[model samples]
Target: MSMFDKTTKMAAVLKGHPKAKEVLESFGLQCSTCSGAKHESIELGATNHGLDVNELLTHLNALFDEPPGK
Candidate 1:
């Protein structure tokens, strides 16, 4: 999948994606289960929370882009 895939839902990211929750918490966002975030895209969340979208994107990518067991 492309790094900037807007179709990725935040809920799915948190549910099955490993780095999502850690990144969110590092940014002081602890409510991954909140209804507003359940259906929103990562970009939407970054915008709403005043976070840098590019930084979030980098973190998300690092989680997925690394070699297995690296």
Candidate 2:
């Protein structure tokens, strides 16, 4: 199962996943540099950004499916 969900904190996601910043950026979320990322959940961020939470989560989780050292 994926480690991230809509309720997962942005900070935790960024910290726990090596490519989280890239994934978030691709979805137009500058979470890595946003102060709110410290406490903001993916759902909240997605809502605020007008992004589909489920789609964002799918892309975020897909980072795990990459081959090692990608």
Clashes of each: 0, 0
Candidate 2 local Cα displacement, residue 17, angstroms? 1.1
Worst 10 residues of 1 by lDDT: 1-10
Q: Write candidate 1's Cα lDDT for 2-36 as tens digits.
A: 45455567787687566668877898766476787
Q: RMSD of each candidate?
A: 2.3, 0.8
TM of each candidate vs. truth: 0.73, 0.93
lDDT of 1: 0.72
- Local distance difference test values of all predictions, in order: 0.72, 0.91
How close to the true structure is residue 48 of candidate 2, measured as C-alpha lDDT?
Answer: 97
- The reply for model 2, stretches above 4 Å from the true place, is none
